[model samples]
Target chain A: MTFFEIMLLLFLIACAISIFFIKRLVNAVVVFMSYSAIMAVLWLSLESPDLAITEAAVGCGITTLLFILALKKVNALKEDGEADRDEHNI
Target chain B: MSIISEEGKKTLTSFSDWVSANSPDIPAEVVYPPKKDDHGHGHDDHGHDDHGDAHCDAHEEAHEEAHEELRSSAYEALHASDAPPAAPAAVTAQPKEKETVTEEGPMTERTFVRTLGAGYRLIAAVCGVLLAIILLVTVAFLPRFGSAENPALNEVSRRYLEEGLTDTGAVNTVAGMILDYRAFDTLGESIVLFTATVTVIFLLQQSRRKNDEARALEEEDLQQGVRSLPARVVIGIAFPFAMLYGIYVVLNGHLSPGGGFSGGTILGGTLILAHLAFGEQYTQRFATITRCTGILSVALLVYMGLKSYSVLTGANGMESMVPLGTPGSIFSAGLIFPLNICVGLVVACTMFTLYSLFTKWKA
Candidate 1:
């Protein structure tokens, strides 16, 4: 059980670092969702089921949806007009 | 706030004088044209006066409105009250705001690309190192994590852990602490969410209108973009199930790990599915920003009212009329049940509102 928890934490850190350096916004957001799910697992293993629930629902579910909706608004990763978007991007 | 003595004030003035002397010469102000009207409608008049083609005119108006809407109302209110005499000074006060947002751009190509050579990067690195050292020193002095004698393991927390269920009729100790003992903190969190939503809506209201204009054109066509056959079939199955699970979590919060916060997030996720699977226009039929705003405000107000009453009762040393029905039961926790409901409403509304605002509320 503890081994699984340690594995989850390591995966969580990996997800976080990967998301940071992914370059593509959509891919970063997908990685972020995985990170949130892994974090929820970590919280569960810590005997914090309430935080785990929130981390899964709000962090994994809602935040990822928020990111995807935003990507749609920006027409993200389409690459056709990505060059134009790149210049305007912060 | 520290009280400044006469000597301290004199020293401040001397310091100001020294700064003025040492700093580079102040640049002469390049004043903008005096705003013609009090309501910041001068831009509106200018937009209309162009007499351009309808589509282009509409586009320009939308663009102008979006930029103008980004500006603070407090600044505009001050402009309105000043009787137009202080217009020049006010414009100068917000130098960046007055800069023309036009096709060519505000700054020249040379200015945009200009760098401070190597020295600025070196200074930044040194400052970054110094800040890191200061922060590390502060962290080094903090009580170690999970230490038995740490301030975080105070008596209040221990008492809550021991007696929270018995006293509050909530099996979930976290729920008891947040929604009962320290409810004001949760109230503040809800208010923060409400404020953020309000700010986003206000800032993007004009863009939302622009999006609606585009939507108006697209609305005439049949719905084709988001809702494919397979996507529709899957979402139709998933959406209701998600909503069911969300409500279950909220209702059973006192007995379980989940509460309004997490359950609300689940509910919000359901609505996001409504947007993605059904398409913007389809979803907007039900989840309008106006409707969300109404629910959000009402929920927050109710939460405040409930908490205020609780606070007053506690202050007066009076027992609450609310019944603690039964521990480990559904209807057991009295006010916690209603408070959780209110929090759920606020959270769902906020998530929906944020999604709407970020996408320019196109639906």
Candidate 2:
């Protein structure tokens, strides 16, 4: 494989692993989004433009937005001030 | 137990001992408060009643005095302190009082549950590791990527490529292969999207009914979309062009790399952006839930009917009546173009509905 392809694959693996280790849900979602974006680029490099487009639009865009919405619904996306107050109360 | 050897038994016992040691400490006195009284009862059963009666009376008097001392000390602490230390003391005392009653009552059951939980975790870990090893071994045996000896480069792909354009009358072979050759698979995918949208609507609507105050709060939030004037202006200017590009991608599926799913997602994203910029009320006027559902179902029905006609004709050894126009023209590939539109509509509606439902439920 070329250097770029190897780097992309490494980044993908790192993102997947770090998602499990990341404590913050929002940060994990962002990592997952970057993973999808990288995979879309890999799809393009493999010469399947249709698959690349679908991956970019669905995986990177719609899925990430859906995850963020779900996070918001669960009240995981709290403001810093609110979180500090909660920690103080605890 | 017989499955474990002597060494395993020792290791298991030691592990259990470590777990118990590392677990949060609950005072022994709280856990076994009635043990002393139980010993007294046992002695009374073996000895004279007069001696047992005197011992029980002395025990009761000592318990009452201890309770009085505890209450007086707590009162004094509450009155004299700044309340932080007293708060922790109360928190600790409350749980101990509750645990003394409940723990004594269900001691056997609690141990059983603890053992069950440990067994579950061990089994889950073992199963997960076994599955991962199996997957890795399978991956190791798979044919090398892009190798001529690969099984995937077979007669099926050959047929799709060699006769694809002449057969389907579309320049984009992948589009022809998906929307024309494998039309039923595409139809199933569109149905899946439609079903998902309907399910989300059904699930969220019930919860949506009881939260009028939250809904009003969300409405107020939605009205305050893209607070910066410049951002709103930029979105306003770019919205139409982005929408046009999405439509172009869907319409030119037969002639280009773009197709129903990708283009439809772009369109759906554009709609979401519009909602974010101009507020829900503005978007609602054009794309209400009722109207979107109507459009979605109709598109799906049309796609089903067209595919059914094509399938029935091909099965009966009859020629298709629809003409395959010039390959590169916009109006070519008779059913493929219309099918792309139908699939695009289904996907766009599903994405839009999913986003709106999630936002509504968030409130």
Candidate 3:
């Protein structure tokens, strides 16, 4: 893979991993959206603009909104001051 | 069409006939409630600025009648109950229409049905490692990516590369191949989407109409300043451009990388954006479930009918009469142009329907 492609892949992997590990559901959903956006970029790097467009539109846009809406319905809210207070990490 | 009175009378008479034919029991007058103020629907307490279309007004009137009937029945039930007359007064105080969010707090760890022990975690890790090792070993037997002599890429890719241009009269080989060569596969996939939409509707048939909890959250979001004015303005600016670009991609499918699926999804994304920006009421006004189903039905019918005709004609060794226009131009592909539109419409409706159904599913 090219340098930029490798970097994007690494970033995507990191995002996916972090999404699994995140404690708060909202934070994990945000990470998942980022992962989808990066995955779209990866599709673009592979010279498939069609796949990229679909990934960006459906995965990141529609899906992220759906996730957030579902979360709101289930009240996926972290308790006040119960989550991690470490400001250094995302 | 000249004068408001004449046009209104025309639409009104047709509307009355439609109601009588649809519901012979309920008289037309009972169906259309008294012509109230501009805000026609009784449940429309929220000051929705009515766009002065006669069709819209008629829809509101229908809703208003239904709302009134529901209210009168509720009052009768309250009166019929054994409780005191004062209980009915209390009943009037609690409006179920506004009861969106339940009085419940956020989830806690204790709410989980069960928690895994350390021993189970250790066993899961071991099993995951074993599975990963087995998958890795299997991967080694697979052919390398982009190899010139890969088995999967031998016959089909060669033919697609060679005769795709002459056979399809399209510059973009992928589009030409998918839209013409392997059009059957596309049809199957589109049918799968339509089936999924129908399945969702069948499963979540009688959910409460209001996507109440989600709207409650949005109202809360607005109150807490979660939604900003600048973001709304930005989306307003982007909406038209996004719509134009989506149509452009679909129309130029034969000349570009994107086709019906991707372009349709992009269009669906715009509708989702509309929901996020303008709220469910606005989105529902335009992309109602009934309207989405109608559009989807028509699109699928066209796609299936057109493709079957082409396939049948091909099997009979009778070539289509329409001449394939000059390659690289907009009208180059004979059937692909209209077929792409059909696919785009089906996909767009499918996405919208899926989102709406999921968001509103009470089950």
Best by DockQ: 1
lDDT score, candidate 3, position A11: 92
Strongest candidate by lDDT: 2
Candidate 1 positional error at A77, Å: 3.1
Residue range B224-253, candidate 3, lDDT tens digits: 322446877887799889988889878888
Query: What's each prediction's clash count?
Result: 0, 0, 0
By TM-score, who's the top model here?
A: 2
Proportion of true inter-chain contacts also present in candidate 3:
0.51
With a 3 Å backbone cut-off (N, CA, C), the pairs that clash in candidate 1 are none
Docking quality tier of candidate 2?
acceptable
Q: TM-score of the candidate numbered 2?
A: 0.71
What is candidate 1's lDDT per residue for B1-363, written digit by digit as tens? 233343333322222222222221311111111122322444343332232212222322333333443334432332232223323332333445343322124235324533543456678789978998999999999998578989999988899989887778898888888899989999999999999998988878865454333344334322333435688788879998999999998888888988899999899888877776776677778788799999999999999999898889889998988888888888888789989989988998899889856754442
Docking class of 3: acceptable
Candidates 2 and 3 compared: the better one by TM-score is 2
In candidate 3, how many Å is residue A39 off?
2.3
Model 2 residue B248 CA deviation in Å: 1.7
Q: Score candidate 1 by TM-score against the native.
A: 0.67
